[model samples]
Target: MKKIKEVAGNNTSDLVEMNRSAIVRILQQMDVCSRADIAKITGLTQASITKIVAVLIDMGIVTEVGFVKGEGNRRSIGLRLNAEKNLVIGVKFSRHVFSIGVFDIRGKVYTQQETEFGLDEFASDVVVEMKKQIHDLLKKYKNVVAIGFAVPGPYLRKEGRIALVTKMPSWQNVNFVEEFENEFDKPVFIEQDANAGALAEWWFGNHGRPINSLAYFLAGEGVGSGIVDHDRLILGNLGIASEIGHISIDVKGPACECGNKGCLELYCSANALLKKAEEILPELFEEEYENRWEACNRVFLAAKEGNEKALELTEEIAEYLGYGCVTLINAYDPEIIVIGDSISQGGDLLLPTINKIVKERVIPEISGKVQIKISKLTVDPTLYGAAAIATDKVLRKPSEYLVSK
Candidate 1:
């Protein structure tokens, strides 16, 4: 016990001078631990924990929650992060819309707002509109400390910018972090949306089962995947991995924005499915022109009500998605695959078929253990992801455990 506390104290002291990002790491690991418990767990001396906790308390970043009991009437005082003290901003950028949110270090989304910028506006008008949205939000809650972003395309982690193809022409290769930081005069961080969503699932959603390995499918304006194995996000050498949306299943099929033919998103994304519906029900567009979310939900409800056209469209979408799921299942051998974002509306209609295809395509042994389903955290995946990013960044660093105490 003394040795452990010493180690924890050393770790605490070692990372003491780090900014919020490194501090968040320590807090994330101290979830169920008291200040003393944290000191012991991190192998830091109690004195070090005292100083850190004192600083956090003075800053209103940490607070005493209550007393905790150990194995046999062992009493300890608990500490929790004060998420309401400092506001954090997160923006999830997609081709058609942006999900904006405000949170604190405890991974709570206190406020959420979204704005739609059509395909025609992603470059020229999007940044200006984004600034307007931020100003508008600041009018409501102005204490934003830092901003984190999740962008649809592959991005360079170091520079925090779009590095590769994006359906939106203007955003491609744009150094968003530098641009936003220079413009807003605040620190900025950016990551891939799917990766952020996967981190959200791992940190806030159900990942506690023996199966920590997961494949996260995000079917929004585009389809993408984020792979989590052994409780860590699998970011490859290029800082991008699990881009299942662009996987070409049909060599001769329709061309994709990623310079591929017959990519999964061509058939499975909300945009792709909406486009398919547009060809069949052109009149539906006359109404929900701007807010297609409602219209898309109606498509799912129509399928649920057994509308033949809706059913066919939904099934077509499911088949393509099932193929993508199977590919991910075979490749990653995940214990579970969570589907999130817009396509999750068809989750009930999608999961069974996805499992069926995986069963047919993958090894039966792996298929039996793998569970494929949609995230219950859908309506707020990006929101929660952004909040988690704040928790992770602001708190310092998240340890390997989901509940790290």
Candidate 2:
């Protein structure tokens, strides 16, 4: 196959940049390898690979990690990325919980913590708490270069504020980027949670396939989608384009805050699933449903264990979710759709039904053999994704972010 630069027709400077990105990309995928292996994979000459690797090593981006035995007692030194040299911080905020993590350029987390908010706390308090955590981390580590915040709603790129995070009325119109940058004394980036999750999958979960296009669906208390096409994220004018939750699946059903009727989230979100469970298993809810999240988990566990009622309810939720996926697939024509967040905890019991319903709803021409799968990073995609966005700046242009040792 031809190289990426060959098809893109890059000039000398662009070619150089592409070569650097390719080298870093190879190292990221391989995690550790000999210089010869990198040259073979990147299709760069051995001399060129040596030159680039030497520069990277000098800049503290790559390090020699011992060696592997070769023929006749020869040892080939394995080079690995030095992710801990410079740290990037990732922050994610939900209604009741906030998470902060420090990650290396390769998106490996070095340290992380989650804090839950009390019922009456406001956005200012959240910001203060986040700043305190970051300040403490910086004093300890002292190498953080950038911070990324993943907000749960539309984040305006130009204004640098979160548009509207439902249920957390105090967070509306809050500028996380500005607030974080001011407090932490570092560059900050804000992205929709779903969009950040999509980035995480593409940057870290490629699994050596390197898919150029895919859709990541975040299905928590609300539903949203993050789309990547041609290896680039599609953020609309306000930086929140794919609000799948607001997509009206039923015109005559209940009204939504976005002025739509029967939005996808109303019927298919994790909250919606739990609500369905509450209605179907009223006695169970009365006794065991202490938390909404716990209730959602129990419902899925029951479905996985072949409980007839739970299975039937899960199928219904999957059908509604499939409707949203069908729309996403038809509109974007992505190669695959990865579903994450609390609802995905249903695991195998949830995927097949979602796949079946999407296949049934969409025309073959539109579906075009799209595959729907569960997220590999099922725990916290947004947190990793936020870190990826910060680190990606360094990866794409190492000269800008890498400080000479």
Candidate 3:
């Protein structure tokens, strides 16, 4: 009977909201539980639980279901979150493509669409198209309570502009907050794509409960990471804390777009993998690819089919990814690390080498406790992460976001 600790709030109202949020979060993960069960888990008095549950039930955020057995084997009413009624829109904006999805707080996806744009395409035009599509989805799904946007890092969260985006300099000037904050009627939450991925894995991914910390290593078109410690994102002063991709793996290596030499991104990103793939396996790219994910998949398929060159290339990439994991473990000491995005599609081919490297590089005690795995999210982690961003916010202050029926 380990009790879940609640986050302390500043004031009376804040404490009330935090208590409600804790209850809702438990329900979100557990699906259904009794007031006595919530009280036991949260360490809140039965009276406090009753008051908070009443508010949540009145706010249309929680509903009473059939009876369930309590701690002492007594029957008690079960309360569940009204997740289907509270939806969120997740938008993943990246170098070559943008995706939009509608999801509930429980990470259930209703619909998702992807739009690809050229690197030469105007940023303003892309924003216009994204806004139009979101509007269309909002019109269709009336239950949507908020919107979550995930942009590439090193995104300046406070400034609401991307500090730098490789090969896409034009996007640096666009203030996402100004662009989307007032554009939609519902509140809009913006986060770096990696951070979004972390939140997605934290709230949605099947990683089991009570995770002390989790790190999401994103190795897609761009390289980055997001960290979640104790149900909260580890956002630094400007909300961009874990930019692991820019960490220099080689001090004397080629200069990266971030002005760093021999950065991990240059060695392990989808761009990096494709660069080597095209040189070693020319026939694989005889035709154009719909996206980098597809291009990377071709190489993985080649390796899967026992192509020696492709296998070597994948091992090399996996070794670098392993290096990234080692760094993540030393830097954050997360309970688990999830490798995600396009590169993770090679999990079957990549894990053996990656694990071997980690086993060699890290201490036995540290390496033994840390579990590394590829993301198993059905939707793209970044897109699903966008929804998680909103879901995280809405769950925190249900009264503010969810309307009372």
The residue ranges of model 3 lying beyond 4 angstroms of the native Cα positions read 1-9
Error of 3 at 377 (Å): 0.5
| Model with the higher lDDT, candidate 1 or 2 | 2
lDDT of 2 at 346: 76
TM-score winner between candidates 1 and 2: 2
RMSD of each: 6.6, 5.0, 4.6
Tell me the lDDT of candidate 2: 0.79
**Each prediction's Cα lDDT score?**
0.71, 0.79, 0.93
The number of residue pairs in model 1 that clash at the backbone is 18
Clashing pairs in 2: none
For model 3, state the Cα shift of residue 96 in Å.
0.8
Candidate 1 local lDDT, 278-297, one digit each (tens): 88866556665556566677
Candidate 2 residue 275 Cα shift, in angstroms, is: 2.3
Candidate 3 residue-wise lDDT, 1-405, digit = tens: 999899765988888888988999999899999999889899999999999899888878899999999867899999999999999999999988999999998988899999999999999999999999999999999999999999999999889999998999999989999999999999999999999999999998978987999999999988899999988899999887899999999999999988989999999999999999999899999999988899999999999999999999999999999999999999999999999999999987999998999999999999999999999987899999999999999999888897569
Per-prediction TM-score to the true structure, in the order listed: 0.81, 0.88, 0.96
lDDT per residue for candidate 2 within 1-405, as digits (tens), equals: 756653546689777777877787677767888888778777889899889888888877778999966557688899987767768889888877888998877777788899988647877888888889988887877788788878886667778776666667667757766677677667777788888888888877764565768899888878899998876789888887887888888899998776789888899887788777778876557676544567788888887778899999888888887888888887888888888888877778777778788768888776657878888883478788888777766677765665457
